[model samples]
Target chain A: MNIVVLVKQVPDSGADRNLRNDDNTVDRGSANNVINEMDEYAIEEALKIKEAHGGEVTILTMGPDRATESIRKALSMGPDKAVHVVDDALHGSCAVATSKVLAAALGQLNADLVICGAESTDGRVQVMPHMIAERLGVAALTGARKLTVDGGTLTVERQTEEGYEVITAATPAVVSVWDTINEPRYPSFKGIMAAKKKPVQTLSLADLGVAPTEVGFDGATSAVVEHSKRPPRSGGAKITDEGEGGVKLVEFLATEKFV
Target chain B: MTFDLTSEQDQLRDAVRALGRRYGHGYFVEKAKAGEHTTELWAEAGRLGYLGVNIPTAYGGGGGGITELAIVCEELAAAGCPLLLLVVSPAIAATVINRHGTEEQRKRHLPGLADGSAKIVFAITEPDAGSNFHRLGTVARRDGDGWLLSGRKCYISGVDEADHVLVVARTEDAGTGKLKPALFIVPTNAAGLTRSKLDMEIVSPENQFLLYLDDVRLPADALVGESLDAGLPALFAGLNPERITVAAMGAGTGRYAIERASGYTATRKVWGGRSIGSHQGVSHPLAHAAVQVELARLMIQKAATLYDAGRDLEAGVAGNMAKYAAGEAAALAVDTAVQALGGAGMTTEYGVATLLGAVRAGRIAPVSREMILNFVAQHVLGQDKSY
Candidate 1:
């Protein structure tokens, strides 16, 4: 089986504050690039399956030249190979534009399965994989918490607000992993060294038969219209004293609706 | 030449963090208290090539180095499942076998260690020796095509769970002008060998054991590397790896503690419904500790690289330095996380306090913080030997 994991280079969510600038765009300089958190889960899940059943894992990502860093990280995580889409126009692009570019890149690779993170940490819009599925005309599963692939049969469990929903799809489908799924793995030193030699094929929009007019920030469906800092909160009343005074607080709570 | 980790290393960091978060501190705390190993986490880590990060690819390993090994431990410890066996199994035993063991030994043990199917425990520290490695009393005498070993070892970790133990002992007759140290692979179930559990007060999943070798015999091939004549160099090979692994364990523990504290401080509410993190009282210390942890992690990577590059003594110094820094950083990070969590930190359900005792061991066992400082003072700083 051949599996392709869609890894995105995003600013580390924990360090996302560094990416903010007065212009309302992600400050590229201060932003440390990393694989999307959820996509890491997808890559880990894919590796787990490949380890159990003999297969090759191919990592796919569409971003600038630096995005290959995320792909290399995926490859180091034991992926057999990788594909990097290096187009300057993809910078500051929305999820839709990114998905369209990735779909074009992935279209050229032959794979039995494709997996992606449910949402990129930078833009939590959560629409990339679904849009990729539509573009590629493949069955799509979103928010998968658990995934198992057996002989071209795919079983996925998705977390819902109320409970969970389990769905099974055929081979050659797309899966967008949610955060609740299996924990992703850190690249071991061996993976890192070996990743240096692993094949990472690079392509541009023209290589995948994609026209320049259909890509870039203009192609993105969603854009930030306005941005502002969250106002600092006001102070609260202090509940002073203890013991008998605490009992008085309980009595006060009884008089209030909190009781 | 880049100072940052390679892309793959970055991916590994992200992946291990994600996987570790799945079970997290709550699960690890329960397992530690019950004295049960996190076999689930260990198995998953092994499958993902996280456990044997440094073992060679030909042996079913990731073909990485000590840096990967350290990353695995740091990531797992950060995720709350710091497996001491990761240090013992692949880092020490498997590494020794792969480097020095005969082809059969490497072929037999490497795959299992890499896949987590077989576990090998490392035993070197003895009660009598007590860090004075040359003073160890364990002796192996030649028998009929085998060796009869007799001695005792203390504070050996995870012997009960090991398939075999790589025991460090002296071989050949003592008074015959032939005095040298040797290593032997002793099956844990070998007859005439007895192991007793040490009732440690700490709550680590891996327990220490006292090993007694009473006329225990092993095959001739069990002696790793060269014969008794070339002892010290072979012994140091295994010992150096052990030290580097300890450093990795410290890195993992520190990462876990910092993550827990950072996550809590980032969003935890306080006065005026604002995150308590906005207050200097809470945020400043965390920031300080974060710097310390990062500094220790840098030392850990440097040590791992030197070790992987086969710079032995330099690697030793780096390992000791990294281990010392990481031990302190992990303990402080966990303690700070607990404090930052306020009331929730103390609760068993919260799981931060469990790491407190576990991280403390980094400063106490394998090698103590004082021991590391002493080593640095004497060896690196050219100070007088105090110990």
Candidate 2:
């Protein structure tokens, strides 16, 4: 099996994030860029499948040059190699454009399977796997809490609000996973050192046969006209309870519809 | 001339910091207070190759030099889990064996040291010696093809956790019939070897012990290097690495203390609406300690770089100075942190006072600040030895 995992470099969700005032895109210049949190789980899943079945695991990422840091970090988690799609024209590309570029890169690799996170922390759209799968004309197993591969068949326990639904697909499928799948491993010292020597193939829009006019802000299907800072939290109602403290708490819960 | 760590080194530091934080100070203090070792953390670090960063790659180590090892030490310490055994086992025993041990000895030991599965502690300080090698009472006498060693070592750290102890003893010179120092790898379970734990005030998981080697017999292969001539140089080989790593650990502890205090003071409001850090009385001391810690860190970097470059003579001078600065800085930082935290710092929940004993001991153990000053006075200043 030749598996491809999609990785993204995003502003750390734990820290303060902002948007550029000029075009309202993410402010990557001042932010601490790290591998998307859920993408690590995807990487772990891809590595796991490769470990059990004996295949190559390749990381596929699309972003600017700084995204190489994330690629190296993901490689240290035991991936075989990486394909980095970097182009200034790829800037401000929305989910639709991203999936198109990624699909093109995946097409060149001839991957039998592609794995990715259900949603990115920054976008949280939960649509990249489906979009890429649609573009590749392959089956997509989205929101998978558990995945099993046997021969050419793939089975997944697709997570839902109530419970999980069993889904099955053949080879040449895109599987997007939830964090419930498995725990990720820390990079070992040897892995970190070896990652420095691993091959990282860099490609641009032209290299992928992607025209400059097909991506970037000009080709983006959606645009954010304006963005603003989230309002600071205001103190909620405080009750000074006397002897009826329990009754007051019940009343407050009822008023807030939490009871 | 550049102050920046290589990208790989930076990645190493970040990785170690994350690992340390995952365990955190709470786990460390809980283990220590329960009279248990940080066995899980140590094993994980070893498995991740953090423990054997300085060991040769052929022996399953990272093959990096002391600079890499120091980063591991400092990052772990900064996360409030300083492992003293790191200074002894990897820094002292591993380096000495790799540099001066015989090829057979290296083959037998380096792999284990590199993988963190084996720990070899060093034992040289004796109750009677008091830093004076001339007064060392530990003597090894030839018996057939083997040797018998007898002596009492005081304040040896982590003997219980190690499988072997590198014993430094004096042997009779065949040519001159005079005593000279030699190193022997003695198994901790060797016959006639016994240890008694010392009650210490430090709140640390590692324990110190008084080691008694009474007629401990060992095969001739136990000796490090090809001959007795390898003894002195082998013993000296471990000193600079030991001093440099210990200093890195001290500098890390200082950084930990200052960070804790700064975090507390910045949010802890006692008067009016302003935080306690708004007052110069509380903030100035922390700032001062931070400056001192930064200075000590620079010296540690210089010393480690010089040592790794194989300039042992210059490294000795810098290592001593680095140790002295770091020891004083660590002690001061912990003290100032406690003061800044006020009543909260005295409580174990705050985690500042727990390091008081360890930092205080740092100024005295392995090599004391006064002894370092003595070395600098004689070597760097061309002054007569005071002792």
Candidate 3:
């Protein structure tokens, strides 16, 4: 099976993010760039399947030239090659437009399977895989924990709000991976050395036969109105003394709405 | 010089983690209990070019340095299968052989050690001498071109598992009244070498041993480097790597404990009609542990960076500091995790308590916390040495 994994370069999950004054967009200053965390699992799962089944893994991502650092990181994880759909305007691209761009780029590879994270840490709308599936006209499964391929058929266990749901799809399909699927692989020294020489084909929006207006902020559907910090939690009531103080705390709690 | 890990260090961390996860904690525990080494994990790691992170690429190593090797330890520890032998074999013994061994020694030992096929455990500490290595009583007497070694080593981990034991012994000349330390490779099957397993309560796979080398003899080639006097610098080169590896192990233990607590408290609720995790009492400690673990992790990475850049002095200080921080962090994290789980924490099923002993090893062996404090006070702070 030939697999293609879609990775995104977003702010580190732990970074503090904010909105910029111009156009009220998210200020990328405090947000350190990294390969989306969930996407790490996706790349790892794809690599595992490729290693088990003897296939080629092509890491696909869309961003500016600097985003190739994320691709370089993915390539270091035993990916056969990488393809970067580079566009300066692609920054701050929403999931819908991002999916469309990735679908357009992935359509050229004719991959048997395309894997992606259910959602980027920056924007947790959880819509990319399904949107890419719609654009590519391929069956898609989201929140998958386990994926198995036997002969040309694919079976996947997807986590749902209720429980887990098992889905079967044809060989050529798109799947969005949950972070719980598997631990991501660390890149080796040899992989880092070799990734320098690996083929990372860079393509512009024109190369994918797509126009600039079709993606990026202009094409994005959702808009962030504002940003605010999560209010700090209130300090709890301290129970100092052991037994008698515990009774006092109970009485205080009974008097308050907390009881 | 730039003291950063470069991209290669990052890659090494990832690869080792992947391989480690394949044969994780469960596998490690089983092999450790069975008195067998995790040979599969070791071989696979070697095949992936990890066992030789700091060895020269010309000698079947990845041609990186101590930083890369340290990353390997941290990643594996995080995966719950920290390779203690990596400290002695690849990091210390292999490093000495590569840098100071004769051409024939390098040809015979480097490839095996690099590939993780031949396991080497280095012994420097003596029971009576304690950490004052200069007072060590292990002796090597000249017998023509060969030497006879007699020594008793205590609390040496992985002696039973090692193919070759690199014993550090002193050679005393009656006339000069001077004692000089020498490094020797004594095969486990060497005549008159007897090892009794140490019954340490720790849960690690490698067991400490009490080695009794009674007149173990070897050829002149068995001596590592030039002579007893020349081994100190070579020995010091390997120690920083060991420290880095230990720091990584501490980080791993901390991460494992924190992860357990994080998963437990994230859903284990109580009052407010949910899990008690909704209360600040449980959540705050977990959060604090998280922050400390991250800080320790940064230090581990920094030490690794300096060591990989060939900054020995900086690496030595950083490695000790990082190890100290990580050890404390891991101990606190595990303790807090146990407390968070409450009654379930003490239960073996939870596995959090199992980490307690492993993390404690970081504080005691390799170098004690008191010893590190002394080093910082004297060398780092310019204060008078207490010991």
Candidate 4:
């Protein structure tokens, strides 16, 4: 029961974000970097699986050196160890390239199972699970609303537009988790202190056997052509609901062709 | 000189903060109102090894110091659920034993203290002695290899919950025939020991006790260290952590009050068609409290650092000043919160008024504000001792 949780560091959800003017890319420097909120769910899920099945949880993340902060955070939540794929060439890598690097590392670690968020708050690509699964020739269960592992099979309630559909995959599979699965537990003070001694291995493209020509901006098939800041929204009109306010509201809605 | 916490420390702070938020003010208030102890939170904290952060690594505890422990105290207090036992148990008793206790003593206590399985409460204050160690009436007489102890301890926290009481007593030095201070591990259920709960004003989860030890007999192994010479250093070692923890709690409580006041004023509208926070009258006091709280926290960090580095003399001054500043900050913050909420602050539903008693008590207990000023006048200004 070896679990590898894929985590990411993104701009803090509460912090203000800006774009780099030169490339119209996100300004990772201005905003404080924090663990992707959805990745917390993934980490929690992995911890739960480990707790129930008796296995060690290892955190796996692909980002710049700054992303190690996010890895430490997951470790604080009681992960046994971590593998950080940090390389300059890893920057500007799309979902496909990112998954390639993750699969390579997971293969090297020989992970029994890989868990990830349905979508990272920063990227919102929602393609890592399927992409990594396709690259590894393993099964994938994405958009998991409810997850349970029994024997060698991993089962999930895949959320759909029309209710949900049950999905199951055999061992050595990829699974994407949603926040609705379970509330993440706060790392105990003991866990934080213990995490300092946990091993964190840093790897580059060479270490992962990833080619320099297959990652980063040069390797990315998609690129941001143009972007702009959204215009500041003005205040909306307020209506007071007096005795005849309902009639006035009806008239206003009729005037706007909404009723 | 650098004030920033390390990345690992920051993570530790965040983790404890999350734990605090999970319990929140309501949990503390409910427990206090129900006259029950916060045993759940305490057990969880202990089980997680947060309580043992200051204990040495070789003792089956986290290899941290008072600096790390203060972070835990401050964050928990900031969430409006300060664990007062932390001040007595880990910060004092644990530190003393780790510093001066024999290998047997350390082995018997440190692991349990680190894991929160066994709680040892510290008792130094007596009805007649107070802070004056020379006036202590507790005496331990050597009878063969064992000792006979008699003492009256007042205002001791968590005596009922603890397995043993670390009693500070006067004993004749083994070699010198003169009476000197010594520390003894007195069992709570010892044959001659009796305890009565004290009626206190503050609504906290911890209860105070008046302990009467009438010729309590203890084995020779009950003594903390081999020599009377080590007692003073052991006691001083405990005091630094105690004062530092007090300062942390005060700063945290002040922060909690200011947050409540600001949150209330930001939303509550009045006759002027503006939020109460927009008014100078409502905002200035909270702003002032914020500054004082931040300054106190800085002092606490400094004092904790000095203490862990074995600079007790320096830590003493900083710890005292930090405690005084933090007390004033807490008083001001809680006062402003009460005024900010007008009527709701008086009610227990909002959870602001419950802090009123606790904040006021923080100023006087552990050590009073005037005593701190006296210490500065005598110790720093080189003036003649007044008391």
Candidate 5:
């Protein structure tokens, strides 16, 4: 079995984040960039499948040149190889456009299975697997909390508001793993060094048979018109108790309809 | 020539930093206070291959050199769970074995070191030898085909956790009629090997041991290489990485301190909701410490690069200097951080004070700051040997 994991590079989650004023996109330099945290689970899940059966794990990510960091990080988690779809023209891509380009690359690579996080922390566009699956005309399982794979069948425990639903799909399928699936393993020092030698095939929009006009901002079906920061929070009320403190608290609570 | 780490190194740093954050200072202190080891973290890190990074690829390692291992050390330290064993075990012992061990020994130890399944602690410091390898009292004399080794080593770290010890002993070279440095792989469970723990004040999961090897007989193959003569160069090879990794640990602890202080001062308001960080008094000292730490880190990078490049002589000079700079910087950084936190800094809950003794201890151990200065004074400054 050959598996490909889709990952994304996002600004450090703990760092201060800001958006570009000119457009609605995030300002990349506001902080450091790291592999999207949720994708770590995807890498872990793929590694688990490889360990259980016999197969190779390949990490697939799309972004600018620096996105290679994401690929290397995922590869460090014991992926056999990587496919980095890097191109400046790929910026400002919508989830649909991203899935199309990724599907094209997956098509070129002949991936038997594709796994990814349910949602990207940066984009929060949970439609990655749907778009990729639609494009490839393959089955997709999203929000998978538990997963198992057999010879030609893949089973997933789809998380729901009620509980969980077991879903199974045939070969050449896409699955979006939930963070609860498994704890992502830390990349060993050897894994980090060995990742340097692992093959990373870089692709561009053209290389994936994607036209420039059909990718990036122009190619997207939907785009953010504008984005703004949330207003800063104001200080809350602080009370001083000199006398009748209990009575004052009761009065205030009653006045605020809490009592 | 670029000061910035490559994209790959940056990722390694970020990943290790994340790992460190997962097991914060709280966990580290709890284990230390209970006199327990950070077994989970160590096992996880080792299993992840963070430990044997400097070992060769054929030995089931990452094929990286001291440069990568130093990064791992610093990142872990920055996360407040500094793994001191990393310095001795992988950085020193693994490098020595890789460079000087026979193929059989490498096959036995290197793969385990690479995967973190096996650990090999380093023992060179002796009660009488101190910093002087020439004065080492450990003697390994041939008894038939094997050797009888006897020595008392002090300040050996993580002996309890180690499977084997790369013992630095002195052997008489019959060919040259001279006493030269020799290395032997002594099993920690060897018949005559005994270890006693020393009480330490420093807040760390690793413990120091006083090792006594009395008439410990070893097989002829226990000697690392075929020749006992390839001693000094092999010893120096391990020392360079040791110094570099220790510097990385220092710089990392310094970073940990500065970050803690900065976080506290940024939020802890005083005098009418004004952050204390607004005062020039607290901020400048932290800033100065940050500058010094950055400078030391740059030197560490240079030293590691030189060592990785096989420029041993240049690496030796730089590694010594980097260790000196980093030791002082860590002490300074920790001190400044404590001052910035005022009373909160001393509070154990704040986690800043836990590093104080450890950072100060950094100046005196593995190799003292004075020894480094003496080296620089003699080698770089063309001065008379002070020691």
Candidate 6:
């Protein structure tokens, strides 16, 4: 079995984030970029599968040059190798354009399974796996809380608001996992040292058969006309007890629909 | 020359930091207060190969050097879980055996040390020696095909948790008929060997002990190297690594204190709704401590690099300086942090005061600041030996 995991480099959500004034895209140049938090779950899942069965796990990342840092970090988690798709044309690409470029790259790897996070913290789009699955003509198993692979079949427990639904698919499927799937392991000392020597194949847009006009800002299907800072949070309502504090607290809870 | 750690080293730092944070200071304090060891954290680190990063790869280690081990020590200490045994066991005991022990000794012990399953604590500070090895009272006399060791060792750390103790004892030189230092690996549970824990004020999971070796018998193979010739060099081999790692831990503790205090003071408000950190009175001390800690860390890096590069002489000078600087910096940082926290600083819930004793002890233990200063004066400055 061969597994390909999608990794993204995003500005640390714990820190202040900004948008570029010129294009309103993410200001990656000035922010601390780290591997997407959810993608760690994906990497862990792929590693678990590879550990259960004898196979290879490849980390597939599509971003700017700095994305290699995140790729190295992911590889430190015990991936066999990595495929980095870096191109100037991929700059300012929208989610759809990213899916197209990733799908094109994945086509060359001939992976039996594709693993990714259900949603990215930066975008929260939750559509990359489905988009890539549609393009590749394979089953899209999204929001998997649990995944089990046996022979040529893939089974997942798709998480839902109420519970989870059992979803089954054949080979050559794309699986997007939720954080509940598994706890990711920290890279060991040996793993960190070995990651530097692991093979990381860097590919360009031309190598993936992607055209500049198809993925850049000019070809993006969606555009941010303008962006602004979120309004600072206001002081919450204060409750003073004058003997009727319990009644007033219940009323406040009812008003806010929190009870 | 570049000061930057290799990418692998950087990753190892980040990885060890993450692991340390997961266990955190709370776990450390809890275990210490409960009279228990940090078993879970130690096992996890062992499984991850963090504890054995400096051991030889052939012995199931990561095949790194003291530079890597220092990173592990500093990162963990920076996370508020300073393991003193890391300085004693891996840094001193493992290095001594790996460097001077015979092939049979390495094959017997290195694998256990590399995997963290076995711990060998160093016992050299005797009740009467007081840093003067020539005056050590511990002696080993020939008994048939073996040796009978007798001595009283003081301030020995982590004796209960260790499987073996590398004892520094004096043997009668056959030709000269004078007492010469020799190292013997004795099982902690060997007959006639008993230990009594000392009540220490420091809040740490590792405890100090006063060990009595009364006619503790050991086999001929128990000698570290093939002969008595390996004794002096073996004893000296562990000193550089011990100093470097202990200094790294001190620097890390300083960082932890500074980080904790900075985090608190940055958000704690008292006057005019401005954080206390905004005032120079509170911030300057932290900034000063930060500078001192950073300086100590640089020296630690230099010492570790030199030692790993086989420049033992240069490493000794740098290592002593690093230990002195780090010891002072850690004490100052922890004290400043406690003061900055004010009333909360005295409280255990604040976590700053919890480290007060440990940092205070760092200035005096293993090697004192005055001793290091004396070393620099004599060795580096070409001054007359003061003591």
lDDT for A70 in candidate 2 is 90
Question: How do the candidates score on chain B by TM-score?
Answer: 0.93, 0.99, 0.94, 0.97, 0.98, 0.99
lDDT of 6 by residue, B1-387 (tens): 345798789889988999999999999999999999998888889888899999998888899999999999999999999999999888999899999998889888988887789899999998888977789999999999999999999999999999999999999999999999999999999999999999999898999999999999999999899999999999999999999999999999999999999999999997988999999999999999999999999999999999999999999999999999999999999999999999999887878888988988899989988888889999899999887
DockQ, per model, reads 0.29, 0.73, 0.39, 0.65, 0.64, 0.86
Query: Which one wins on lDDT?
Result: 6
Q: Which regions in candidate 5 have their CA more than 4 angstroms from the true location?
A: A29-31, A56-58, A81-112, A134-140, A150-153, A168-172, A197-220, A236-259, B1-4, B175-177
Which of the predicted structures, 4 or 6, would earn the higher lDDT when compared with the native?
Answer: 6
> What DockQ does candidate 6 have relative to the true complex?
0.86
**Which residue pairs in candidate 6 collide?**
none
Question: What are the C-alpha RMSDs, in order, of all predicted structures?
Answer: 6.1, 1.6, 8.3, 2.9, 3.3, 1.5
TM (B chain), model 3: 0.94
Q: Give per-residue CA lDDT, model 4, range A1-259, as digits (tens).
A: 9999999888987878877888766788888998888889999998888889998899998888888888888898889999999999887887788888999999988888899989977778898899999999999999998999998998899988898899888989999988888898787766776777899999999999999889988899888888888999977556788788889888889989999
Model 1 reaches what TM-score against the true structure? Answer: 0.78
Candidate 1 CAPRI classification by DockQ: acceptable
Ten contiguous residues minimizing lDDT sum, candidate 1 chain B: B1-10
The per-model lDDT (C-alpha) reads 0.80, 0.93, 0.82, 0.88, 0.88, 0.93
How many clashes (backbone N, Cα, C below 3 Å) per candidate?
16, 0, 11, 0, 4, 0
| TM-score of every candidate | 0.78, 0.97, 0.72, 0.92, 0.90, 0.97
Clashing pairs in 2: none
User: If chain B of candidate 4 is superposed on the true chain B, what is its TM-score?
Assistant: 0.97
- Candidate 2 C-alpha lDDT tens digits along B1-387: 454687678778988999999998888899999999999999999999999999999888998989999999999999999999999999999999999998888889988888789899999999989888788899999999999999999999999999999999999999999999999999999999999999999999999999999999999999998899999999999999999999999999999999999999999987999999999999999999999999999999998899988889998998999999999999999999999999999999989899999999999988988888889989999999898
Identify the leading candidate in terms of DockQ: 6
Residue B358's lDDT within candidate 4 is 89
How much of the true A–B contact set does each candidate keep? 0.42, 0.58, 0.75, 0.83, 0.83, 0.88
